[model samples]
Target: MSNESNLQVTFSKHCNGLFKKASELCTLCGAYIALIVFSPSEKIVISQVPPQNSGPMQFIEANRSAKLRELNAMLTQINDALDIGKKRENELSDLRKKNETQFWWACPIEGMDRVQLQLLKKALLDLKKRIGQHANMVVSQGTPTQTFPFFVGNGSSSNMPIEH
Candidate 1:
């Protein structure tokens, strides 16, 4: 036979022997094994001994599914938070509209009992006191005061300058 043919036979025998030894090692030790061979003619061989019922592809798919489940759970939580935020925003908007439509002082006082009327009077008194205090503060700050001339209600053309 030709020298090239002999070399090819030798190479094939060595590759087989290597694979056999690897298989025996895995069987005896119950260890995982991966082997790769590249031939001079650009041929390739690959072998893997994975666990009994699982392979690399199965593990990857399982991990991918687990991640998907985790992401889905997070998405659900975010959506729920958004829903709650929207509900709170709607409630605030309604409250603002109610406040805009009717001020506290503008509400009907006809239905107020004596206690409610007293509370209202107290609130008004407090408000008046605060207003007076604010006015005094403004005056103390040396803000320029303006005066306006007005005619007295009595049938007389008199210009009375009221300083404010």
Candidate 2:
């Protein structure tokens, strides 16, 4: 009478064919199937094949063993993936530490010649001021279009969040 009822009837008709084929597969394979199906409208249907000529316990045990093997294989694959990711992370961390140590600016610039250090300091200060001005301009101009706050800062150190 209504659209919901029409949809239910159509869904029921569709499930009839699915259940028929599933039963046939179970019969041919000598395997029982326990199925839980859901419709788009959230209606659930559960179906289980009846006990075969062989006992139900044997069928259930075989299913359990098969599922256990599948689960173990999946777990092994996940463990392998995790180990690979950990090794890659360690390698990347080592590379980053090496890179940081190799940088000239990473050392104490104070011990260098006064003129060189002063030039470096002035260059760094100008870069910082320019970056701050750019960030403020973006924040002031972009806030009306977007709700999130986006701020950029100087890139004196890799440890800091902002990059040049």
Candidate 3:
């Protein structure tokens, strides 16, 4: 008897066959491999194999399981952050409604009992219209007017243009 072995493995043109070959090599040689690929649309493809001999399979399995746990932990963290953001958004919307109803700018003049809230609202609308007209007049006249940069709410601008 001779301790000799001859093994032949063939693969189709598909990537799954390649994966099987890699897995076979890992199982026979007691090695580990981490593979990553990508499609044209920038999606990720990944694979991993653990050592097969010297009790390393358990270690590899553990490591792979650990990685899965890590991914789960990260997903949980992301979910928590999203939940917090949603809660904050709801709170902000509620605050806006409250603020709109209790607008100090629309309050009546001090010590004027006869002034009503509706009247104050009409006055503010008139003032806003006048301001808008003045701004349009200035812009139409091509006056060198200074305008301040302002944001209506807390929104972030990203430099990278995401495709989807």
What's each prediction's TM-score? 0.36, 0.36, 0.35
lDDT: worst 10-residue window of model 1:
148-157
Q: What is the TM-score (0 to 1) of candidate 1?
A: 0.36
Better of 2 and 3 by TM-score: 2
Candidate 1 per-residue lDDT over residues 10-88, each given as its tens digit: 8789888988888767655557889898865668878886534346546666787999999999999999999999999
Per-residue lDDT of candidate 2, residues 1-164 (tens digit): 36888988888898888888887777556667877889858978999975354565567668889999999999999999999999999999888667645543444665446654665577578667776877787898874332332222224443332245
Clashing pairs in 1: none
Candidate 1 ranges beyond 4 A from true positions: 1-54, 104-164
In model 3, the runs with Cα more than 4 Å from the true position are 1-23, 26-54, 104-164
Preferred candidate (lDDT higher): 1 or 3: 1
Give per-residue CA lDDT, model 3, range 4-100, as digits (tens).
2211111123456667888888876667887775533456668897756546666777788999999999999999999999999999988866764
Top candidate when judged by TM-score against the true structure = 2
TM-score of 3: 0.35
